[model samples]
Target: MNKLLIFDLDDTIFETKSIKKESVKPIFDQLEPLLINKFGTALTAQIIPELWKYPFDFVAEKYKFDKHQNTEFARFINEHEYKLNIRTFDDFSVVENLKQEKILVTTGFSKLQHAKIHYLGIKQKFSEVYIDNILSSERVFKKGIFQSILLERKIEPQLVYIIGDNPNSELKAGFELGLHTVQVAKFGQEKSDYANYCISNFNELIPILK
Candidate 1:
């Protein structure tokens, strides 16, 4: 049977933490003073985590910032959104190599994922892109959405494999649905259960794919 490869976007394809730390955090820092001016002392603590939740819209709604401010924030974020310092584990080659044999699966917000994919210029590498908006619901634990992709696409369970960093949810979903699973460790994360195979680096995956 033909094979399918599903990848997680954040830590899998791109270093999500790094982008948040370098790019997004700075914008939040700039917004801190603005938030303080708008909301006062309550701004500091609330703004910190709030910037992360929905990041853009959350700030906009909380401050009642006009469209200009919103557009400026989006522009600032989009400009520095991706640093591209780290290479994709498979690099460009992985997607190209897989194109010969399998499909690729991923789930995220459409705009956010699309920006990164376009910046990386690997949008065409995937046979399918399953953004969260396309799914039936908006929840983060997206196992059901993953399952829907398989059923909707008419792909076989055995032919599908999920590759990601956090194995708990994705691995559980894949295993429960009868697909193969591979876990790639995040920078500071220790090994965890749920993955059928775990590796620290993407290069380690080549042999397992065989």
Candidate 2:
């Protein structure tokens, strides 16, 4: 039996679908000044998501903003509004009821991710949480974070399962460690490499975990 079940935070465990959109609108106003002042005008908020995928300094260079401005921007974004959407997809409850020790292994700033977990009401469900801070400054994430978890807990790779949306990083890293990998694909997602199984809802994992 799998002793540990690892999960990705965004788009996997907690999604924005069930949240009230109106509650999150003020977040745009909160960060608009940083964007406007550094870049001379606010780019569409849509770019914020893409901006996070790369280092702020590199993004600043790409946009012709002063190099240090990106650090300020990243700091502001990292600190604000993570509590806006405290809702999760319906199937997330399946994870809560599981017998195995559930661990969150996501890549991002811990402050923001932790706030999301707290507000989303799943923080208590996880026995452990590991955030890959390397993602904040790098795009290609290959660092073996699970190496520490395995050694510390003495959990064998074959007895663990990693579930996430990203095929390249999350699934690939777990697969390389010889752990079972599951890609929690979004609707219309293409095939995910390195996944032992791919499913759209956490409900599907109920039987798999059994």
Candidate topping lDDT: 2
Clashes of each: 0, 0
> What digit string (tens of lDDT, one per residue) describes model 1 on residues 70-145?
5555555546554544445455465466543444445544555666677667767776666543222354445776
TM-score (C-alpha, index-matched) for candidate 1: 0.65
Q: Pick the TM-score winner.
A: 2
In TM-score terms, candidate 2 sits at 0.75
Provide the overall lDDT of each model, using Cα atoms, as 2-decimal numbers.
Answer: 0.63, 0.70
Q: For model 2, give the 10-residue run with minimal summed lDDT.
A: 134-143
lDDT of 1 at 207: 80
Evaluated at residue 196, the lDDT of candidate 1 is 77
Q: Against the hidden reference, what TM-scores do the models get?
A: 0.65, 0.75
